[model samples]
Target: MAGLDDYQFFSTLREKDNPFWQRTSDDRDRLEDPMDHYRRPTEFPEDLRNPAHGTPGPPPTKAPAPTPKFNELEGQKVNDVQMEKYGELSINIVSLCAENLLSHPFIVVRRQCQVNISSHRYHVLPITIVPALLHIQSCQGFSAFWKGLGSVLTIKGITLGLEDCLSKFTPWPKDISPHSSIKTIGQHLLLKSSALALITPFYSASLVETVQSEIASEKPGVFDVFKEGLTRLLSFTQPQTGRMLPVWLLVVPTVTHGVLQYILGNSVSTLTSKLLRRLHRNDQHRQGAVSKDSGSFLDASIRLQSAFIGHMAADVILYPLETILNRLHMQGTRTIIDSLDVGYEVKPILTRYEGFFDCLNTTIQDEGFFGLFKGFGALCIQYALYGAVLKFAQVIIQEVTLALVPPKPKPKIQDPVTPLAPSAPYTPSSIHPGISSLHTSPLPPPRTPYGASPATRRPLGYGSPGRRQDVDMRAELEKHKSSLALDD
Candidate 1:
């Protein structure tokens, strides 16, 4: 009986391992008795379950998905990941510092304006405002940093990746491969799509969220408050027809800015950058001649020169585009906050300016050519100084990075051939062992001139001596010198 029980236990164990039984078991585990679509644990209808016999509750809303994890240190091990994360953290912290330093001035000015400081001032003097615009708040700095981060990741980074892929996949002339025009168009598409997908949603939310209302209302003048409020009117997924102007601003103004930047800003910037770099190079060359340090503006002076010039020109000269863009965003909106008094009447601002071109034409016709540059003074204060600070901040960050992470000491480049001095002493390696061993004839020692003794041998400059009968080399040299002296 015990043997039989053992056999039964063994059989059960073997059955668990068997493919057929395993499949059966899996099927059994999966299988469940059929139930009603709206199944309840009590086996009752909603009407029955409810003591009041009320309607059923709607299905629970799905919670937002958990953020996905990525291999932050994807290169290798846990230690590697930690190192990479730390490096990235350091860079981000440095960038944050830069952003804060650069943008805080503008934020402070706006804050001052909010507080009704110098209330009557309509047109701020660029000189006076530039200094004020230099200050950045911690929050404002972080906002700018995050905004820029979003811009890069969603728009620029994606565009770069797409462009790289396209450049690789698409065949073209070797010289003009990954054509600039084509890439620019793609960039526009990517930028717009990115703006719509990423920026627009956040922007739309920020509009109705009442987050900036405090500052928006704090600015002096009822008209200015209204204008700011109108600018921040609600714009969700289904923005009203009149409210669609911000969309137009997002599309045309950005594209126009890009076009202008490419044509005017880039050319001037490049030209300026090149000139500055050339000058810097010249200065460095002079400095190197004088001192051994050879320190230019920055360690990577070329990059710094380009960044500063390009960024400065864009911020200062191209700021008018941003003003126009804002104006465009303001146009075509039907909703008006107007005066709080019921009796007060407000003029309809823009009936004809229903879209981008219309708004642009209207601005030009009504306000003159300089109308597009309405905020030019403010922009000069904001962008110009901000740009200077930002670029300088970048330089500072790079300098710090160089100091701490100190770029992999650039490989010591070996010269193609170090010219041997004419007076250099001949070594054993200088002698051609094969050539020397080939000849059994007892000639001058290896590397020594043939027919020349080591004591009287001329160094490298005077050509190799031909094999000859044993002779006094010094005597010959002395004789030649005498002959040359006599000739002179």
Candidate 2:
């Protein structure tokens, strides 16, 4: 009986080496009943009691199925998945554009108008306006007016046209509107009133170029002399950027200027009016009313204030463009802002600053918050002149074009010039290429070549007649020299 008990007990134990036994043990440990033939016990005590008494289970079990590993992927499925993801990505980009427009129109406008200020002046306003205003304002005087106007119109038309052309390419979402009423107002101001002020720089730079040429006969290129002069100018102030004039460092001066103008406008006028009233008190008591001239000083002060503020606002608006363009010109890239690299990779000339916040941060980091406004005085002067030149050029060009183009007569077919054989040699004419050189001829109208009407030549920039290179060079030298003197 004891031997039988031992056999039964041994049979109950699993063979440790058997794979079937191991898998069975794993299943049991994992609490998996593969057969599903019996209900689980309610308690551990009941399970223990039934462990020996449960009907003898089938001998162990085979091992669980091995997991398969596949080497090849379904190329078609993968392509489909990728395509789906690309569509999703497109949707996301569209959504982002829409959301961004609704939430941040200022950012869009900011990209359009970058305010440029120098490093030497801290007190002046550093805000920079657009370029169109300069073109408009430059038009003035006699034959020069229409030419200048035409130049400005051309530039403005080109810029706005470019913007419109690019709008279609912008991948904005369905819900987004990059433009806003506020932005439109800002744009108008920037394109017109603000832009006019910035034309001065072209004239100023031209002037400087002129001076440089005059001096070049006796000295090195104006650039070299300019570098030396710039260094000398910086000797009085610590320059943050190696070659830049410390002109941008005087923020206080700019502030003082603006403040002075503001005070001159509103406060001065009010004070003048009050004083004038005191003087007129006796007159009022005698005549029951003061004369219109009683507040003449105040009236003059008010008028002066409006003119000063208007001129100042209008003047400095495009200073940033001038500053940027000048810096670029000095560095040798005249037409475009960026280098040949990707947009983000292109470094701005005045990378000494990133933005308004960056400037303020640098000021605080290097010399406290006060340093942010450096060069305000120089900026005001720089911007005022910069805008003036740009405007002057536009005005001049329009005027010139108008003057040059003769009034068109109704088209009539007259005797057209008869062409000689193709093998015939051409002869040069004595007529000069410019409108200024054209003689007023009383002779019958010249025969049209190929029966084509004479095309009216439009004015070029600033309504100035196209002169010989030597003449242009002389003018440029004179202008440069004048600017250099002013800077000194």
Candidate 3:
């Protein structure tokens, strides 16, 4: 009897080791009858029933199931980001072109107004915006309004591209804190001002082109105008000796005006940011909510408004310097420019400025302090229309983009399905009495590696480790996509 009991106990232990009888802890607890284990022994082959009687081989090694090379969601996200960048770029380019095209007439009138020699001898009086526009229209025809537009666009494109390239290549100091607004602004100013200084010749040439009236009967092409402007800019001859003036004379005023303008704009922007922050904080306090930082919708609107205001303020404040710079640009190029008066008459600059300070002093002495802001009204109106048009266009573009490519729907969250039990003749509940409770009771919430609550835990292949893997995978996918696009 004792020997039989020992055999049964060993057989039960052996049964537990068999793969066929393998079950979760819950399944083992579901056994109602102790004899059930003994009854199940006859179901397996003789070799599996008693491992000691036969040698058990190692399980076959199978290759891990291939993980997907790319995730659709991740790819979509990458595409969306790229699309946004491209869309913004297109919008900016379009906006710039549109603004320049629509507002260029005002610019032409303003330039003419600025360079007009207010003298009794020349009969060139200080011209207002409307009269100047009308005079230019009548004398030079309406087409004269866009005279130097090509040069302006060319200069703008070069400046923007050069600045972008310079900023990318510029070596930032390691010690400078990213949070230090002043240092960052200074660094940006240095780079941009340097860029401006480098392109002073082009800028001066363009300004000169804008103010000069065409003498030839045929309208010149953009390239021809640009070439002629460059020639004129370099051909500045000293009145006394007829020797060409040095390039540095043009560089000084242009660089100074650019640097001062940038500084004033940045100062205004910083002040506006601080004021917005204060107002936001006060509003948050009133609403009894935690104040959000500067990335919200309200903050974006504030930033846009501040930038617009800053640019306007800077332009208004620096109008005198701009006027002086224009005069300096035209100093040696003693060309007959449109007076923007009633008659079909043109006049040459009467006063020759030695330098920026000389130009400023002479203008004040001869034309009064207000002479510096000759075309101020036209400038204000141009910018106002530009801002309104740009804002409207952006909205239209955004709406069109949405209509063309609707945003993807958010993925739905489904409840986790309990892992299915292996197929067998007996149900899991019949395997053991204690396991019966497992089928009837709700599953315990799964614990995350990060100790997150089940409700907050993301599904497999998302968040933390999975998200990192997805990012790496997405990078590889992006490379492949770009290569494919290039090939196409």
Candidate 4:
């Protein structure tokens, strides 16, 4: 009796009269509930309603939920990302310094070679790298090789750091597509070129400091040299009067070099990467299977090599311009440089140029086209050594850093498993004692059609159309009884 009452109570809870059931429009309007903010039209003042039935009121407003705050773990993750970026930046700077330090001698040799000219009096024709290096060693000693190294390092480091910092604030585009429009490419090139051009004065100063012969009697500090270079760069005095070329003259060449170098380097890198990928794919097809680790390592190697190759190619192509630029930097500075020796006598620049094209024309006419690339061999050797040293240093630093501070392992997440309830075993029962118990399996549950639910499976008398008829339990029991009696 209690079980029957409980069932009746639950069944009644689904009826329209139950308070828990969803209210209809008319039923809600008829009710007078203080808690319900959506009041009936009659309760409102006449001015608020239409002439007949009032228009439906707007839905009740909801307060927005508070935003979730970052927890400690989330904050830690963000910090880690920032730290990683800083770490990579530091590593690159360190590697750059190391590379420069190791290969600076070659730089000295190259600059000297570039500035050296063949005169009829000295007959210093066919100036080569080995001879030039030996001459510097004999005359200026080993220390002369790094004469302007401090200025170079300072300029390069500051420029690299400043550019990186500014890049964050700059509205430079990211992840540009290969088929990007001309406008986008122009914007990218313009922005990058401008950044480089802005630092042209400093670069010119560094170049002047580099090409100037070391003064033994009164050695100037790095900062002093740098300041002097700046002073000379901004002065408009002629070469014979002993003043460096004006900084403005180098702007066009610097910007042009920056833009062209960027374009050529990227183009070469892209082509190299594509070629490598094609070869890799062909090899993979033939080999059938390759380990992911090996493939990833291969990709890293390819990128590093491609970048190196691109930079080298750009440098090679632009060597003439660089040589001319170096010469221009030394144009007004009448310092006796050890590298420009003809018959063991130091020589300074005697020619003056009006502009970049004028300098280009003068250099070609005076020494032929090949003369512009005076120290090509030294440049190549310097770059090769720099690349090798930079890579080695980076690897060593990263390995040591990892050894000192290993990465923390990620936390494992295990989902909660829901254990299903055990189903009861099937047992048949006889409907009638008179009929001998004939074993028969239980019938399968009725099939529910697609999109059908318990509400739609109610008896036909229910208000809903397209509803199924409910099964009659009593009729099914009587059918079983009749079947058993027939067996008897």
lDDT of 3 at 55: 68
Query: After best superposition, candidate 3 residue 269: deviation in angstroms?
Result: 4.5
Per-candidate TM equals 0.39, 0.20, 0.56, 0.55
Residue 373 of model 1 has an lDDT of 48
Q: 51-103 in candidate 2: lDDT tens per residue?
A: 66676545557788988765234544354345444443443343334323221
Model 2's TM-score against the true structure: 0.20
- Local lDDT at 438 for model 4: 19
The C-alpha lDDT values of all candidates are 0.42, 0.35, 0.63, 0.62
Against the hidden true structure, what lDDT does model 2 obtain? 0.35
Error of 4 at 13 (Å): 48
Encode model 4's per-residue lDDT on 60-137: one tens digit a residue: 567699999867676665655554455466555655565578778777767767776663222123334556567667
lDDT of 2 at 129: 21
Candidate 3 wrong stretches, greater than 4 Å: 1-79, 98-102, 119-142, 154-202, 215-250, 267-309, 341-345, 352-358, 405-488
TM-score of 1: 0.39
